[model samples]
Target: MADEVKLHGLAGSPFVCRVKIALKVKDIKYDFVVEDLINKSADLVKYNPVYKKVPVLVHNGNPISESLVIVEYIDDVWKGVSILPHDAYEKARVRFWAKVVDDKCLPALFKAIGSHAQEQAVAEAHEQLQFLENELKVKGSKFFGGDSINLVDISATFIAYWVGAAEEALRITLVTKDKFPKLKEWSDNYINCQAVKDVLPPREVLVGFFKSRFGKA
Candidate 1:
């Protein structure tokens, strides 16, 4: 199928998972190509020459790199319920949250997982999560965009699954129910939603992998 859509991604990557969820939501069928990040496939390198990363979207042979960029491209091309809001201001807000997920939340999360200054890293991650909690409070929305998932929710897909895995792997909890009730509720909702549940990597496997990669806290 030369004209079929294809995706290059790595297993258990939340960035990649974002695309999967969006494609499922949009009802767009795509061929998924799992890449070996370590070895780096020729096609993966060739298609995404700049970043040389996975989660590349090949639509009828045209390649698009970066997960969020690919997701937006998907939304634009497909005809369905949009991942972004229709209103100009609302769309900007969604993009803002998405940027926060990529620039702040994810970096803080990885820092908590892999940094030597464990306590400081955890505190920093907590701060970022708290910021998101505030956003939810201000919007008074169940999920990032509302009752249904949207681009902001998709952008923070890691929080839905990988955060718990990282917590179990490290023996430290960042998203305790007490500290982040609304955030925790949102996380539960996001993971249990039909669109997200099937695509999530098993928590046990994620925990094991992270445990081996980062070792016990």
Candidate 2:
């Protein structure tokens, strides 16, 4: 019998989009279980009891929680496409950058959007983004993975897509063409990729969603 795969996720979620992009890149056929985070769902709760979050990947009755973990799991299990690097050092570097995106960049980015200390938050976000800008400049590749999307690129999907929506909704700019040219170029190339484009939420939809949460600018 074939394995059954289902992704329980909320629309416009960058984390969820990460898993969706990974699955799309691997050409995995799976069912999408749209989750209402407000009410929550029994299956979502059952699948991920710890956090009770969306983006739980259920495969053949087993559940995997956390978006990055799920993406790694999919990459490990599936063939044909490679999300992580084959070399040990390169793979570790990719994982390191992915963690930086989640731990350092994401918090700063969101805090810049929502924190009361606007100046401090924005400054911190700029610092974090500068790290990425430097990495892109040093690598001199269209993507963190070089020539294609990889785990690092997947992890930074929020910067590529959601930042624009957040900027529009809040009438602020975090990433600018002149300020971080390499990062800006990377975002353009990443979002325009066929697989990435296929899984991304519509820009207007994301803007509307962000507006609803943060109030109109």
Candidate 3:
């Protein structure tokens, strides 16, 4: 089998973006195969038999699912500018924050934003944002990993891209100076980075679409 890397994922998904960011940071070239997640292709199922999710990374015919796992795999296989920390404890810490984003944070944001009741959605979103802000403070880092974007940054960046759409869909603002200053500043800087800015979906389009569909409005 050829030692080639290929990514099968949806274009607009934050999960896929995570994989893209890792690949870009490492300067690892790969093939891109966009998939319709709603109507998953047979190839996607073959690659990821369980979840059949997007952001599946195929490496020399071996398949890996989950964006974070894919990222670790990429980092290990093609080490360049190392994204994960050298210390084991620090690596675990980065992974811990990543888990928070993957398990608690991302799901809550999506659910709260996708809820039909505007008030409830906004309330939940606010609560989650507060928790997130506290985490940022406790960590005392520019990102979850600090300084340069790391695994924690890669993990968080996935859902951070969708805040605009979430706010519009739920008719509430999560990022504000009074509320999440560090997060807001970090988000602005993160998005404005040439890698993210040039590749992200149009904000207006995301808002309009999610506002209609996810909001059920």
Candidate 4:
């Protein structure tokens, strides 16, 4: 029998989008179970008891939680397209950058959008984004993964896609071309990629969601 793969996720979630993009890149066929996060499905809780989150990847009978973890698990199990680098150093570098995106960039972005002290939070987000801008300049590639999308690019999906929606909804731009030229270019390249474009949530949907969630600023 073919391997059974199921992704429990919420619509318009960047984390879930990462897994979808990886699956598309590898041509892996799977079922997507859209979960209503507020209601908290039993299967989602059962699959990921600790976090009880959306974006749980259940393969055959086993389950994998966390977006990045599930993405790495997909890369490890699949063949054909490679989501991570072959060299040990390069692989480590990619992992390091991915961590920065999650640990540094993501939190800063959330603060910029949601915090009461908007000015300070936005400044912090810009500081974090500068790191990515410099990394892109140094790499001198269309993506962090050189010619193709990889774990780093997938991990930074939120910055490329969701940020735009957040900016639109909030009427405050955090990643402008003037402040982050290379990152702006990279975002253009990323969202336009066939694989990524195919899997991304609609911009309007995301914008509306953000507007409803955070309210207009």
Query: How many residue pairs clash in model 4?
Result: 0
| TM-score rank order | 4, 2, 1, 3
Count of backbone clashes for each model?
Answer: 0, 0, 0, 0
Candidate 3 lDDT: 0.77
What lDDT does the true structure give each of the candidates? 0.88, 0.92, 0.77, 0.92
Better of 1 and 4 by TM-score: 4
Give the C-alpha miss distance for residue 177 in model 4, angstroms. 0.4
Q: Estimate, for each residue in 34-58, the C-alpha lDDT of model 1 and write its tens digit.
A: 8999899999999999999979999
Off by over 4 Å in 3: 1-3, 215-217
TM-score: model 2 vs. ground truth? 0.97
Q: Model 4: which ten-residue window has the lowest total lDDT?
A: 111-120
Query: What does the lDDT read for residue 120 in candidate 3?
Result: 72
TM-score of each: 0.95, 0.97, 0.88, 0.97
Stretches > 4 Å off in candidate 1: 1-3
Q: Model 3, poorest ten-residue lDDT window?
A: 113-122
lDDT string, candidate 2, 128-196, tens digits: 999999999999999999999899999999999999888888788788999999988999999999999
Assess the local accuracy of residue 209 in candidate 4 as a C-alpha lDDT between 0 and 100.
89
